[model samples]
Target: MRKKVVALVAVLAAAAAGVVVARGCSGDGTSKEARPANPNGEKPASGTSPEDAPRPMGSAVTIVVDASAPPSEKGPEVLFSATWGGSRMNELGRSRPDEANPEAPMSLAMDAKGNMFVLDQVNGRVVRVGPDGKPESVIPLKEQEAAQDMAVTDDGKVAVLDRFNSKSIVMYDEKGGVLGEVPLEGEGLDELGFVTGVFVDGKDVYVEKEHGPLLRIGTTDGQPVDRTEVPGRPTRDGLSYIKAGIIEPEAGRMYISSVDRATMQHRYTREIRQGSEIRGILLLDTDKTGTIYLATLLVQNDQESVVLSCHEPLKGIPTGTAVLPVNTMPEETFRDMAVLDEGGVVYSVRTEQGVSYQKYDCQ
Candidate 1:
């Protein structure tokens, strides 16, 4: 399989054909969010594909966020309210810096039970917050070490990318005890660079390999499962070409969103509905029923950009049937996003002030 993929890549290179790779909280900052030009300078389709007809986005209501009124300990400052049977935004909690560590969160992940895990990059610790918005445990790391991304399994195993200390990934159990650590170099993965994405689906964990395929590791003992390579435009990283990606593993299919630096466009997999106006997909997540939610950026102009929360159906078509603009400051950056099974979406919006989390309840 690897040989076949490599051969296919070689053929694409010979033809100058564009490929798709996949992104996350950490990005390479080479993508322009507005719908980009076709890399091959060819028109593929309009808004719909021939097999699956296009569906108009029905009326979906959403709340707007006030940029001036900052989030407080009581809750985040939400500007608007949702009508009956519509989605409403709710504030979870906020943190402040302390002498022991900077409590600011860098990345966010959620488990099946709705427990949230936060990577405090400034403090070099992982804090698990229960569904009640209270701290459960604070797992510390080596001094000066920081986590780039993290993933949590359904059984309560947490895997964190400890980049500063030996470029290793540490795994911890439910009680925040160390299970084991895997160094990227020991195995046959010598070409691997900084891991930018980590995802936990069931008993398996997938880690993004810089310029390489997604490494699937078994959660039981942290052993190798296999590698998945998605072809796409590659960027020259030093002397080696690397592709930065964001990955989400569902029951059967994997959703990948990547940046194609060759054409300065953002790309998604062919499985998705074609001609969606996402421009750039920053976060990919699915609910328990297999509904896909995308936190995307739409660049309107050089000075204006809008972040959208979109919902795509699983079977009828992959196009977003309902879209909501996250009515925040155009300058606010998207940090992370997660979809709840019962019916809500949690995402982080960051600015110079700090990071704030807002939840939209569609239930």
Candidate 2:
């Protein structure tokens, strides 16, 4: 069984300097200009603030689908669809907000057997939804600052990264039994910033702090092992930290979303430095062949997202890739996304209607 993998933002530079500036990427036909360094050195405002950011609202939602595109070449097909947590009443005669009261989904992971573990950040619990798209079980963790991200293992063990607490990663068994907890302090804790990502590969668990040096831990005993620096750690100032990462252990490579900086380098690279219009990267694993699926968000240039397929690796420049847009509503705010073994991509979005999950099939 392969546990669910969530997109992790790379913690770098700004963190070392203790700043959170929303420096947009510039490349791929766009101008490469440096954002001015904050003089006072205070944290800069994000591109979108909480007040202006998109959120699920109202009592109903309108879903649109483009049926003309084929799943294989154009990306995943939406085989089945389900909705959760909204103001509208569900089959149980309870409004979504009243039933589960789920906040925006922070992170999610899926096992090889098609089981999904979703971190309901506001609720502080892991909701496991079966292949049928029905809620199977709910595992709650009490009294934590924030349950940020989660990953599942092939053997059915789930690991969660909870921020603000002394210990960061907590593991759980299939029956919701407590396995163990790993404290995210020591070594590069200060420079690494927060526990941005938790990945389970075979018997070893990979924990990513804000910057570089991804930590390896024992999955069975929860013991820390060697730490290796991730590819593309900046050597000087003016460079940006990693924005997000998707681990494809089987592929022997992890895809990292980063700023448009030439100084940074990675071990195995697939980049889309198409300027700020490229919002983020979403990774999906196909059950058909276990190949990694890469999707880049193009919010500014187009209202939809793009799915890319490339066989060759490029050093710096963007590749001539097959790009297909996944049309999404303008109001939808991508919270988190996970890839299913069957080449299906499941993602969470906050719309004016409410937070909900949607699945798209990939080839």
Candidate 3:
């Protein structure tokens, strides 16, 4: 089986001619909501290959966020409604001299129970929204730290990753209480900006090191630990670890593969061919049923848009796709997409009006 994939790699390499590694958030962005670009104005038929066809192709979720910004407790300063921002009043870093940018939310998260948690860093609080779309509560955060990323445990505890100030992961309970703080300043995790993701796998709290393997940094209780044996991002099923990567720069191509957690061997690899210019991978994740979801930024005909696609876990065969509008550079969500354990993804979109979340589900 490994030999077969190696042979496929050879063929792909030969086709590339000149290959270069590439990684990024997205390329030139547009404020307008994107629609599928089809000369016939129709989705690819079922007979189309996995590389072309996406079943139930690009079905838009009714949960589309309105173009106008909603109001929040922080007043209608023009960012997000429930999530506060754009003000310098009572900030933890207000005393600093070089403050330039307005306060905004850093990342997004959704717990298993279906509640949404927006990392409202500027407000120094995490806004919790119920499934019905009402603001439920706000989780207090360490004011001294400017949180970059965040993750929630299975039971609903929140962990915010602060890279510059505290250099630690502050844990919070489901009821908005502080659990503990796991320091991120030792050993394989020291250097500045080395850690990228914060995750809670089972009883342990893990962080991704350079988007490679998952490092066990502590427990869900915020107890610190130094371990680096995690094979990859552990899937919800606990049987495999999934990874996505770009193989060719000039060519719009990416490979998604699953690795057996126990053996640490590749289960399957599927290289999906894409647009004329590949911007960057926006989201790589899975739902409860082990169905893989991928969102990429691709440019064709000088127009850039995000393509959201889903794949089967067994062989990386694409299940479906949806072309989504992307905000022009200066991404408001930092670099994280919140994938709900139940079924879909929720990501914030920024425009001149304000910020709103775009929600989509895998069909």
Best by lDDT: 3
- In the range 163-273, model 3's lDDT, one tens digit per residue, is 788888888999988888988877677674767678777888887765556778888888888676575677776778876655543456555667888788767655554
Model 3 CA deviation exceeding 4 Å by range: 1-103, 329-332
Clashing residue pairs in all predictions, respectively, total 8, 20, 1
lDDT of 1 by residue, 1-363 (tens): 000001101112213222222111112333222221111101111222233321222222212222222223444323212111111122122234354432334567778787877666555667677777656776665432556677777666787765555566677788877777666554435644445466565555556543234565445345544553333222212111122121211111112234343453443332222112333444545566544444443333232223332333322122222222343433211135566666456665554344455664321
- Considering TM-score, where higher is better, how would the candidates rank from best to worst? 3, 2, 1
**Compared with the true structure, what per-residue lDDT tens digits does model 2 show for residues 1-363?**
011111113333232112111122222423221111100001111232224322211111111122222345433333223344432222111123544443455676788778777666555567777777666777766455456667787666888776566366777888877777776666656633445467665666666544223566446446566554443222112233233232321111223333324555432333222322434344422233323344444344334334332221121212122334443433211125675655546655444344455665321
What's the CA error at residue 338 for candidate 3, in Å?
Answer: 1.6
Cα distance off (Å), candidate 3, residue 199? 1.1
**TM-score: which candidate is best?**
3
Model 3, residue 294: distance off in Å is: 0.9
Query: Each model's TM-score, in the order given?
Result: 0.54, 0.56, 0.72
Ranking by lDDT: 3, 2, 1
